[model samples]
Target: MSATPAGSAGAGDGVYRTGYFETRLAADPNRAVVWRHICDYLRRWIPADSDVLELGAGWCDFANAVAARSVTAMDLDATVLKAAHAGVTAIVGDCTDLSRFGDGSFDCVLASNLLEHLERADAERLLHEARRVLRPGGRLLLIQPNFRLNPKEYFDDYTHVAIYTDRSLTDLLTSLGWHVEHTFARFLPLTMKSRGSRLSFLVPWYLRSPIKPLAGQMLVVASNPAR
Candidate 1:
């Protein structure tokens, strides 16, 4: 994540900038569930020392967590980037045309709750761009809402335009020349493990706890074969 001139191209005109929870969920337990899922997804694949690129990174909460190397957080809204977490090198750009980067530019790519927002064709394009920028054998970790878990739960988010399943995502990656490594059916439960990790360090009793399963989010980790 090196610094470069921040360009405003394709940072669409506010379509992707809406405050998600503020407009819809109103800060409830479900929103908390969503956050937990996001954090869990981050904790699962993102080690503290990896160079990460977060696509469609809305406010950079997860981007802020990368401890391995710096995070290049990109979104289409400069205003959203402005409000992003402090350490992120926020870039206002689109993932569809990641021409600014050369091949294998990042160790990992993190995309949370973003794929369904695009039409099916655009989603495929996004995955192709992701493959192009990732290093050989590097990973792409995605956390997407499962359409099976009540369409309104995911569709309620204004940007959602497509639905997803782990199998469908796996097929998509295969079509783009990537290999699937693992898939988790739930998001909130994984989050609990991550939160448990933090707490175990605080009160050792939590270290012995078992994770609870709440199947609402799908986490997919895929790899581009080493070149």
Candidate 2:
């Protein structure tokens, strides 16, 4: 990712700077390959005809790929609001404060590589907002970097604030009254398009195989508290 400018918008506001996604992925070609399979894998777990909302959706990669009846890509950067993928509606909003959306309005909410960007309080607020926007039994799918797996380099991103692991993430959601539906302690390799050239070919196999040793990230799927 490119360096954030000194006076750039959102520098201290805690939102990711505009053009961050493009700059980060420009150097990697395999990210495109990996995301194709990753999207497919994630889509299998998402029910068809469901309305989906993606929090902190950068460039709408997964949002554009998921097989939902409707897709809304919410990001802190307004840059996404104009040029989103076809069929995906883009909006500028903070994940921690989604009062603009009514309660029980969506069937699924997605966040990838997002939780670590917020402070503890903000992350908790985001969790609550996600739950509130979801219908009863609706799902929340998260893919976040695991501090346990990438402790040495987790801080490489200057914007990251909250670190998490499988256990901590599961506990956080459960404590907030959500049901932990599924947990993959090691799901994907760190960095969308870096560290390995074989990743493009290996991702599909890894998702199918039981072992994922190089995975620097984890997947957590949860459901709203059943009334």
Candidate 3:
């Protein structure tokens, strides 16, 4: 990864500061599978002509996949942003504050595996900023880790700050005055008891039509409420 102009956030605090995509020296197969699933979802929902603002865009892989007209991939790490591809304008910035851009600056805002690293208040504030930057009826796509999933598996990453549940997150969005259009769980849960079971299929099924109130990683699609 190369370097870019630094922003407000400092480098290397070793807390919520680490970028998982940048630190992974080698690719983990299961993680790759999850990334592919995310790409597929983005391709399906995000139109080619839309302008996207991706928060915590570690390496810009999602930007590469989505054929959006314009993508502003923002991250705190200058080195990570430097490695981002041609289509993405890598900006070294913080997601919690969108003062750099005016209101309704983007058609779509994406935050994947980002909420866990933020404190609850910060996460809420970030959502508010997302709402502030989004155009009327614009979409906010959030992909967060599921607490029900094996913590040793997903939460083992040094950067993961907290766990999230489906109900609480959806309520969080609703509290922020955004109308959640869709909520589904993605990523195969790593379980110690049964490694080979077909339970992974059930995860998505439950998310699409949930029986329980929780999941592994809740993908929430909330729209800016009509003013």
Say which prediction, candidate 1 or candidate 2, comes out ahead on lDDT.
Answer: 2
* Regions of model 3 farther than 4 Å from truth: 1-9, 12-37, 151-154, 186-215
Residue 122, model 1: lDDT of: 67
TM-score of each: 0.75, 0.87, 0.75
Angstrom error of the Cα, residue 181, model 1: value is 0.5
Worst 10 residues of 1 by lDDT: 1-10
Q: In model 1, which runs have C-alpha deviations exceeding 4 angstroms?
A: 1-12, 18-44, 189-214
| Candidate 1 residue-wise lDDT, 2-92, digit = tens | 1111331244443333444246322233333344444543555666667789887765656655565778888766654665567778888
Model 1 clashing-pair count = 4
Error of 1 at 211 (Å): 6.7
lDDT of each: 0.64, 0.78, 0.66
Candidate 3 on 138-227: residue-level lDDT in tens?
899887777755455666665556677677778889989999998765442332123323233343344345354433566788999767
Ranking by lDDT: 2, 3, 1
